[model samples]
Target: MIRQIFLALTLAAATALPVAAERIGDAARGATLFDRQCKACHQIGDGATNRVGPTLSNIFGRKAGTVAGFKYSKSITRMGADGLTWTLQTLDAYIENPKALVSGTRMNYRGMADASARADLMAFLRDYSDQPANIPESEPTARKSEPTLDPAILAIQGDPEYGAYLSSECSTCHRRDGADEGIPAITQWPPEDFVVAMHAYKSKLRPHPVMQMMASRLSNDEIAALAAYFATLE
Candidate 1:
């Protein structure tokens, strides 16, 4: 009887796992993820301005590629003219892989492969936008349909060449060959160490505003590639 009860409990827990996983994007957590991923190229909230990308202050419901004075790729502009709005679903899909959705966009970062991460990002964007939308704590239908990837898995599969490409923005402050006065030399470090240090900055475990801000924009794969690249630099 006890064995049967134990089996039933295990099965019940297993059944509940997917539902719990579906509510993956916590808004607070999303805020952190957003800081790390989108803060560099884009700005959101009051007094926002166009930087490398347009201000995302009131992105949802706005037609794509329509922000005044900020240039967009032909594909994005065409899509906007064709009636593209930045709804949560649409943003989620595009965030997964921008080029896949719009062929000529100039946004350089690779698409996020993790559905949960994308969802979290969506939540953050929604919260900060001028008009926010309510996303449920959990959605049974969407949870079952969407596939997810763990960040750890993506990091393990990082590509060094891509890391080298992404490192261009980083090179301005972080010297490639050696350390500047205060900036420690990242060259010749172990890949794992590099990842950990970056995560520390991203999580605010380490406290340099610039480093935290810079580390916030990196995805796991990008981070992995950067780690690999820097590890091999010496």
Candidate 2:
């Protein structure tokens, strides 16, 4: 029964992201930027080859991982195999901030926060000449009543639609499925639990440096919105 509920929630989260193309960036400019800024650390279309860093040919299709050859502080090989592929939005956030996207990753790109630049980068990346890729299976679930939302969290729940919009940022590491290996799918969490957990991260209680930084940056309203939206996952 519990597994059934989890699967339903995942299905609901999948539908929450209605895939759509964004036209806000210029691929030509992004390529130039990539050559000037990104070439030193990462190579394009090299297929798991890691020199100083992992190859980025099919980056959007990969889960968090370390390239086979390059030495990683942590062996993220398992993350890649777990099937939590990167999407355009996830790419954008990671571009904006790498360590924020994956807490323990070793890549040192501070990030390019310009919306147009990042968008253009993603566009360029999506078109890299290579094999077509596929995202793995999503979570499975059966029907169940919506989990009870915490009253305090309910008062601060932002627009469910907007919360849905913001959650794209979360999925970079959260994985589409809450149950993916090594990753905890927070979408199944109740709002109160979400809020409290985030609070723990925001404060010094949680020791993950990256999570703490990201959590500290989020406003209370943002946290509330995220909690509410994640709670509503199908």
Q: Per-residue lDDT tens digits of candidate 2, residues 40-107?
A: 98888645355687777756545666445566546345545565456655566667877775667777
Q: Between which residue pairs do clashes occur in model 2?
A: 4-142, 7-140, 7-141, 8-141, 8-234, 9-234, 178-185
CA lDDT for candidate 2: 0.61
What are the per-residue Cα lDDT tens digits for candidate 1 across 165-234? 9888778877997777777777877887677667656544445688878877887778888888878875
Segments of candidate 1 deviating more than 4 angstroms: 1-24, 130-234
Worst 10 residues of 1 by lDDT: 1-10
RMSD to the true structure for each prediction, in A, is: 20.9, 15.7
